[model samples]
Target: MDNLATTWVGATAKQISRAVRRGDTTATQVVADHLEQIAISDPALTAFRVVRGGEAIVEAEKVDDQEDLANLPLAGVPVAVKENTAVAGLPTWHGSAAARTAVAEEDHEVVRRLRGAGAVVVGVTRMPEMGLWATTDGADGPTRNPWSLDRTPGGSSGGSAAAVAAGLVPIAQGNDGLGSIRIPAACCGLVGLKPGRDVIPCDLGVDNWLGLAENGILATTVADAALGFSVLAGRSPAKLTPPDRLRVGVALRSPVQGVRADEPNRDAVATAAKLLGQAGHDTVTAEPPYTTGVRIAGLLTWFAAAYREAQASGLDLKTLQPRTRRHVRLGKMAWNRGWVRQEQRDAWRAKSLAFFEEKNIDVLLTPALATTPPPADGHSGGSWRHNLIENIRYAPYAGPWNIAGLPAIVVPIGLRPDGLPVGVQFVGKPDSELLLLSIAGVLEVANPWTRHAFV
Candidate 1:
């Protein structure tokens, strides 16, 4: 895989599996090819924190020997998991040294499903500490954007996005508690989908707020993301979510996030909204109840989670990257839970559902990232400062959906002048991840964005 790697990076799991099933390509060959590519390309890319080379080969061989149709859908696909996920033999560190010693005892439910479906787990990608930041600026360091070596790939899920974008893997699993998945997708020119919480079972009993993030796939095509959903979606991982009549709601953000419909992001989402309307779905440009208050209210949950982590472990808060340190400070300050604020946020959630129910709005559409792609050199804030603001201003929409525990899919719709990507999000009702993925496939067919390579 070279510049030619673009074709394979964008290959859907379905394509890889079909090749393996037909004996056109052995799973061993496919996994080896990606491993070789990773060897040559991943050093500067800095996309992985854990490389499971030998371990992955053993698993890929299982695919080669597998004759049963039980794992038919993803037999030869090479995938990367965010370092935060436990993959049996591999360690699941939340990108922190404190976790370095805690090797995983077993596969996380998400990892288990991917393995059960026969996707090869090549390695674990990088992320910010505890997924606290939107940019992948970890205490460990930043992961570069594949589209431009000097730019960021976007964070928490940054390395996963970079790996998939750089053609290291066909798909990489990403979790978005904040805008982790979409941020990188926008930065790297890929498709990212964050489904409703627990639409897939999380074996560990994580706190509800921090659990806002859900594991999803970052791929070059919507179908690739759809394929992951088929192989590794829901509690047991189901086949492709069927497409159906989906009513779409449009939430143009309030003026506070610093941009609007006049902006490219706004236009991209509006265009998507119009396309949905033209597709015979109902589309309305409106606001959910706590529309104006989401930014402030949502921060409560994000900060609370960060605060708890820091206090519980005394997280060496000072040692964290500056912006993250500041977040820990802010989180510590919010010891008081504002039920009124939560009530408003919850009311917005209820209102959103009532509207969805009334208008039969099965899905909602909005900007994946509030602003355009950040400069390739990354945000202008001090590493910590930039990390903080980038998370807030650029990623205003994704978290609200996360807080609501609703499913959302981000599909790349267009590219920026710098050759970066921009995406629109589709928010669905709770547990509607399958429905969201199916709709993403429809929109993906309506507009495909891929084959981008940095080298």
Candidate 2:
């Protein structure tokens, strides 16, 4: 047996699970190591809203007590849930104290699935108020990027990304309404996968950002991500295989007008395309139909989601953060105007799918982010307009995919010239979750990236 005191802080989820199943180490010991690391590292990053210290140890003990462990895919792994998600006994802090909901009596479906798969929930991570912005910060403080404390990890999954990048947890649960998961994955150099709509249960805020939001996994390796995704989707874990030769559509154009990918971001896409070629895939220049209606309706739907969430949570608008208050107000206006229509969203989804058929491509590749992450702190209490602008300017790629209700995954290609990490996005057709993971796995092996930030 290995030393019980040996830290498993930096080990991948698969490694930890395999070790525990083999009886090389106890689940308690692994959870203890991760909890200790969280104690040491999370103070600097503010990644967790609350650390489930004693509770997690007890859960890990339960895993160790199981008579048979062959079926537990995530056996003994420590995972973090995004603050907005329920984790029975914890109040769902929807980004801030004012937005918190009552203590949950039972686990959310995804949380239950994780626990059933032999994972322990260490804590829930933080996010922006009502998850309205791309930079994660609240009255508690900013969730600093592990790569660079001055920059954000990216939101609303910022805390989850920071926790995984700092090795505080092997993987985490994050929901991407806009670019929440992928943007942070790009910023922190991790694999973030947002499944197509309805692939996994959403049940978040009223209507899940008008069907634009979906739950996802963030991890340092593609293997861990695939494991987490399979658990969430309630499927048996399957090994990822290299895909056959596929024609991949490559685009450098930003989805949002007047916002273009910077040199490093564009180069990241190029790097990803080159890796695809080396993997025996064809890459062609193809742009999705980012029509004027899709852009405007998507923006209005984003605004209206905030308004609907506030109303459903019974949160007093006056008590919300200044930026969130404005967002909710705008949401109300957008809702009243009937601008966020289901027909428009369906139309875009149809158009997005047809682009692949017309272009004869298996998947589309684009820059995960347009520019570097914004400053982490000031935006929390600052102007709503500034928050919106900064978010759209840096992260214009991931939102359109969400609007299209298609699966998208972000794979870290390499580091940027500024020392922060950069990643590229791969959008696939419906029911192509495994295909997207396969493509990411290929890039991961062809050109490896730093697994975790040197926090």
Among all candidates shown, the one with the greatest lDDT: 2
Model 1 steric clash pairs: 135-155, 136-155, 151-376, 196-407, 323-384
Error of 1 at 65 (Å): 2.6
lDDT of 2 by residue, 387-416 (tens): 889988999999888889999999999999
Poorest lDDT segment (10 consecutive residues) of candidate 2: 1-10
* Candidate 1 structure quality by residue, lDDT tens digits, 1-455: 35443344446677887888888888888888788788878888889998889889998998888667444677878999998778887666776665343677888888888888788999999887777776665444567887777777887788999998888898888887767787788778777887776665543224644566677778887667777765556334346644655667788864245644337778788768766666667777656555556666677667777777666545676556566667767776775544224575566567667867776667778777776555444432266566656566666666777767677778778776656677788878887767777776666767766645644
Instruction: Kindly report which residue stretches of model 1 are placed more than 4 angstroms away from their true locations once superposed.
Output: 5-10, 98-101, 139-141, 203-205, 208-211, 234-246, 255-262, 291-293, 312-314, 336-345, 358-360, 375-386
* Backbone clashes in model 2, listed as residue pairs: none
| Global fold similarity of model 1 (TM-score) | 0.89
The CA lDDT of each predicted structure is 0.72, 0.92
Instruction: Assess candidate 2 and give its lDDT.
Output: 0.92
Return the top candidate by TM-score.
2
Q: Which portions of model 2 miss their true places by more than 4 Å?
A: 1-6
Tell me each candidate's TM-score: 0.89, 0.98
